[model samples]
Target chain A: MSGSVLYDAPGPRARARNLVLSVVGGLLIVGLVALVAYRLYDKGQFDGAMWDIFNYAGIRENILDGLAATLKVFAMAAALSLVMAVVLCMGRLSDHKPVRWLATGFIELFRSVPLLITIFALWVGIVDAILPVEVNIEPMWALVFGLAIYNSCVQAEVLRAGINAVPTGQREAAYAIGMRKTQVTASILMPQAVRSMMPTIISQLVVTLKDTSLGYIILYPELLQTARLIASNTQVNGDYPYVPTVIVIGTLYIVLCLALSGLANWIERRGRRAKTGIAPTEAKVPEQTGALP
Target chain B: MNVLLDNLDLFREGFVGTVSLTAGSAALAVVLGLIIAGFRVSPVPPLRLFGTVWVTLLRNTPLTLLFLVAFFVVPQVLFPGIDSYLLAVVALGMYTSSYIAEALRSGINTVPLGQAEAARSIGMTFTQTLRIVVLPQATRTALPPLSSFLIALTKNSAIAGAFNNVDLFNIQKVLSNEGYNILVIFIWITIGYLIVTFSISALFRTLERRLEVAR
Candidate 1:
């Protein structure tokens, strides 16, 4: 703590100021939202027939198809990224000077470079130079490879921190038990490190999911890009539907992320339950009673 | 050498865009991040949930996507005819704020609980404890990661190139496309990024040193 708080809570004057600020802020938000709606409305996005287009058979099919592609690409990129992360992590942690330096350099270099540049460069390099022919190896792959390369560096650091957080005594105990270095790393250290850093790991995965949208820049047609195409296609009265479509699309992203967050919370709770055996409510009850003191 | 000499003006312009965007958005983001971090660790369940959701959505989403979403999709959806520059700021600010929230939250977490408890024992309100007591310490600990995120933010602004904006990478792209000096232009852009990153890292190192000396 640096210093003591000068005020208790906001007094009336401060509260009034806060209220005014909030009202202004609220208006700004609502005004922006209204402007978006008005643009869409003016463009006839809200036309009677257009509103029902979500029920259109072809549009529904297109959304599903798009969703499938989004999931497939995200899954592949995420898996490959994890494998690369482990490799990079191991390399960074290695005792060998050359390996460590190479890993560190690669991590820092890729991590510093923009993901879009990586993907664009990789796409051009592979198609124009690396590959024998004009093969399209899923621009989505390029995006993922780029995402994975950068994120693996981040994951490697996270894992390294987790590994370092483990007590030296644990490693010594493992060695004393005649465990090989590999056994100590794989069975003991890695597991504990991963468990401790599970939240960070999960958070990174969320990043992976969001990064899937970057595929749009290369015309890979991930969710946001597809939504843009849908919104802009003149068939939907150009401007108005673009806003609603984007809102719907953004909301979809919010929904997916929130679902993932809920899952993380569930896992955290289950883990705590497994450890304590007593329910959280029951655990809190004792604390509440002790609060009397 | 001729190419570098000829394209110097464009390089300078691009560098300006990158720096301004990074600095402006970063300042707003740090403030927003502090607020979100407060919400994240707040006793109010709803406030905490709001903060968590914010971090999750913004952090998980790709920065480029958010950039596009903010620039194109967000304004198009929310306020049909909002200014592109404002949209850019809003999107970048929100996206950057999420990462700041994460960095700050971790920083806050690292602050010993006793610090806050001691503040409370001294009769400080929750906001008081957080502002006067908690945040200053968190700020120091969070500096390295914050600087790292700023570097990341600067690099990510390269996506502004895709938007056809006159940012550094886009400027380089334009110069290369027009002059056909591809390698030099890209090398220039790369150097520009490295300079930004290295300078920030150096600044952080200096700050860390000063902090140590003060201690």
Candidate 2:
């Protein structure tokens, strides 16, 4: 509140000034929206006929198919990435020096490269070269592997941070109990790490969902690709339905991502409520610094 | 590789385009983000609501969709002369700004309440207090995340290639089409991105150290 210590409560003059400023700001925003609306209207982007293309069964089915493909790729990538994350995290955290270096190199290399290039490389390079001539590598496979590789590195970092966050005392205690290294990691470290890093992990999953759109570049019939095809192919009143198609697609993406985050929030709440195993010791972990979507 | 040497000019142009896209979008994103951050922390409920909505909508949608809208839909409706490169910049800027705003807001929160209180007691206006007292400190905390976001933006800018923007990724595509090894082409593009991203990371590290000393 303005009455908080951050600022003094407004006097009459200050109150009037605040009102004027707010009104001006409000008008500027409204004017900007009106300007965009007017331009769209002038271009016939707001025509009902353009939007009405979605009513067609073929277009609707195409969109649904695209959504399914996108979801399928996302599901595979999400599962593979989590498995890959665990493997990489363990490798990175390995006691052996060569293993640690290999894991670090892999994570850093993939993490630095753009996800699009990774997908492209897998599609054009690895899939072509490694796979037998008889075996067909679908764009879906390329997209899933590409996403899994890149996101596994990211998730590895998140999991590593969470693993490192587990109390040293817990590790010491586990060692004192004569547990093997793998046993300590699997039982003592990983469960607590996953619990602590659940929010960040889920957020990364949201990112993976968003990144699925990149599959469209590799000729994958994902949601964005389908939307583009629809918009380009369909015409209403002699104008392409680019505006309406984009709106629908973008809205779908927004809805899907929001739903994912909402689920994450629910899981986090449930995790907080369940009083199960050993509570993680409170430690101030340094914030992980990286480009997170 | 001989392919890279023979096509130096193509690579140069692509590299330049990628740099321009990254720099232009980063600049626009920072400015837009600052304004949105202002809206977020403003005392007015409506402004706060507007900022929240902007971040929510933009952040949830993928950058590729935004690019499609900007390149295909926006230019058709609003700016006819705008090219794909410019549309890419706009789309990248708009999408990245949401993250920037969130980072700046977090930075702003780290500025102690007493700082604002003291500034206000000294008769400084809210704008003056923010500009002089709050944002300076906020910038220090925000720099690392801002740079990371910019790095991410550089990578995300590759999506422009799909829309006919001849960035580094596009060059890789072209080179591959010309019978060059696809793996080699990808490695080159990957190196270009690494150079850009690492340079950003290094620059921010230096800036952070200098700010630490200043503080």
Candidate 3:
């Protein structure tokens, strides 16, 4: 990439102009870093001594519990949402107008509304009212459900697009073989659609994973909330020890997202190796040769 | 019911604050996003890395945490005397900017190489080609996703209420807890948010259709 860029080397005037922009850009980035650093120093944000507390049995136990709860909720949510996404996609693509309309409305409503609002509403209203017995619908459940609802909508759209993008001839051939609409959709369409839409599905699931942290606001005792509690309770110098906690939690999140990205890249490369469909270059450009004999 | 009805003026004020916060943050986010998007696409290695790291951090972390950190933690720690509302705006603006930046960068990537090559063949500078040819096309490509980001940003601003800010959702929560009609309070809040999100989505749909035709 560097070789190609240098090969198309800029003229002197262009180089000078780019140099000016580069300086300004560098200054801006440095200024942002300085601002964060200044804030940390002035606020005494790094007062937490997590290293010392790391040996404490109680705090360690809580961390383990929190990690379990986080994973449990995330797994349940992702599984539920993927199932919901398939149903919703089918509904949206159905020949029946009512089904399509209902699917569309659901998708629009959940996707438009904030996840926080949905969680709060469901926790306060429906779950609290109907299943107040034998069902402890904690904020954790609310967060997971809310995430599932929103991400399912997004996943549904992705699936619908992928289904549509499949070659029209596949459907025609299936029909000619006397396959019904449902049969065609199940046997032919869904498999191809799933393959094509896997990347977007993984992308939305990564979103779901990150959104698990939102449960902290409603006191879900997720990883983020654990960090916050630990930071507040532990004192190294002074104040609430927010900066170090944030840094720790933020770093954890970065690692998770990068891991997901790596997985996505791997899957994408595998897909390329599989060569599922016609390559773009293989798409013949039509030409008129004056009604070629 | 009557208490809630009578306190409609207070609700309206809160609604205004919510609207203003959404509008202000969206505008700020767009400007910040464009700058970051430019940085990510720039030739400079460190600048590109900065853009990537910024997006990665902001994108992965919860927006609610960012808001709380800005309002409750940051001020208490850094600028001890600063107000929560300004902090909320700054946090939300920065939070939303990261997603918008990603959208715009993807949009820029989708612009055909031929368009820039055509622009430069006539002796246009790289900057000139980008400004005159690339950005306009990228903007059109970005409009749909940008619209969705705006919706997300608006909805997330409800977290301001969590931080004791005088926003619509917070006001409703207060009203509901004060022996006012809880249903009415929530109903109004839902309706208010619905209008904001749906209308913006609708407007964007129209713009998208127009851009499709124009392209």
Candidate 4:
């Protein structure tokens, strides 16, 4: 991770300076930890009972349910958004100006709005107002559609960037062989684009997974929402277990995202090492576009 | 449309809150991000480790979870009397700083190796070389992505609305409960957000053009 070129190898005095800086940095981190620990101890946050709330069968089940709910939304949204991205990407690159304009508008609008607002608006509009009372609309669908719409827009842009990264010569060669524009894009450029940008696409999938937490706002029983319920409803010795609950759930999210990111990196490495007649264009790293894109 | 006019005060309040949240968080993120970027490129091993750890943990975690921690956890364990607004700003700031740092680090990497070597060849120390040469060029390359990260920060402030800050997203919840039409409430919210985000992008584009160097 070191951009070592920025500096020469440390001489004796420079080594001494680095050692001093290291000590100071380490001390700062340790001091912050000690302060937080002292505060927690003063507040009885270290109490065993505070953390024992996880021992309850109902609470464990609720946590599991929340995990399942979050994954359910993520899986559905992931699949739906990918499909929608392709369609939107097609329209975005369409020969028709109107289609391209419509695609661009949809992307910019959704990407600009907050995911929390999109899900909340969708929950209110779709389930509360638009749907007939006879047809029960689950909050889950609202969260899923909201995520799908916002993420699909981002993914479409990523796809467009990827497609643009493809060399012009590949397209011209396709054209010289009498391929139509659609055929050239689909059969030639799109595959290379998708391959070149696989890392970014997966990275965005990680973003989608993280964003499913916004389902909490719409009252969907995702991990964050469930953590709130468990923390608030089940007090431990007259205090809410916010600290323990958050630590546990937040660790779970970190693990899941790290795993997904590891996959993205692995694919990126393998892609780089692959042999091919036409080399994959090195696509620029896509913007980390959400909450958390 | 009339509904927005009727509750114009609420929209105005929300607008102010959103802008304030974005501004506060952006300031914090820039400061923290620059520090982390410094750590990332520094010769110190522990400092680099700290930067990497901070980015990985924060960037991987969802913003909503950070808000949850900021709102629910901070009051209980870290700070006793922090208000929701401050908590929201801190959460958004901390979350966005990771991305900003990553953007800045990549920008640093984009600086040509020969430039650093050339600086060293001329008898410049690491600090002098980095200060006068590397950082300036890196910041230029990093401008576009850094601006995008700031835009993401603006969008992220919407999560604050869910946590009791009176921003545009929260305004929808308030207006809808008042029996206003969802479509109309959303329309206004959308317009407010579009204005903020579009303005940010346009401002950045102008800065990019102004900052353009012959290199």
lDDT winner: 4
Worst 10 residues of 3 chain A by lDDT: A283-292
Chain A TM-score, prediction 1: 0.80
Question: Chain B, candidate 4: TM?
Answer: 0.96
CAPRI class assigned to model 4: medium
Which digits, one per residue and each the tens of the lDDT, describe model 4 over residues B1-215? 79888999999999999999999999999999989988888888888888999999999999989988888788866777988888988898999899889888888888999999899889788788888989889889999898888888888898898888999988989998888988788879988887777777777789988889985
Instruction: Give the per-residue lDDT of model 2 (tens digit) for A1-293.
Output: 23244446778987887788788878888999899889888889888888888888999999999999999999999999999999999999998999999999888888888889889877776555545554455788889999999999988998898898887999999999999998999999999998877777888888999999998889899999999999999878888988888889999999999988777677666666679743332221122233322
DockQ of each: 0.30, 0.55, 0.34, 0.62
> lDDT by residue for model 3 over B51-166, one digit each (tens)?
88888788767776687578657776677788677887888899989989988877877888777677767777656766888888999988977887887777888887777878
Assign candidate 1 its CAPRI class. Answer: acceptable
In model 3, which regions exceed 4 Å deviation? A1-8, A11-24, A47-51, A55-57, A128-136, A278-293, B1-7, B176-186, B205-215
lDDT at A292, model 4 = 17
Give the docking tier of candidate 3. acceptable
C-alpha TM-scores of all predictions? 0.78, 0.93, 0.86, 0.94
* Predicted candidate 4 versus true structure: per-residue lDDT over A54-142, tens digit per residue: 88899999999999989988999999999999999999999899999999778877877788788888777745555556444578998
Clashing pairs in 4: A289-A293, A290-A293
Interface RMSD of 1: 12.1
- Candidate with better DockQ, 1 vs 4: 4
* Global CA lDDT computed for model 4: 0.85
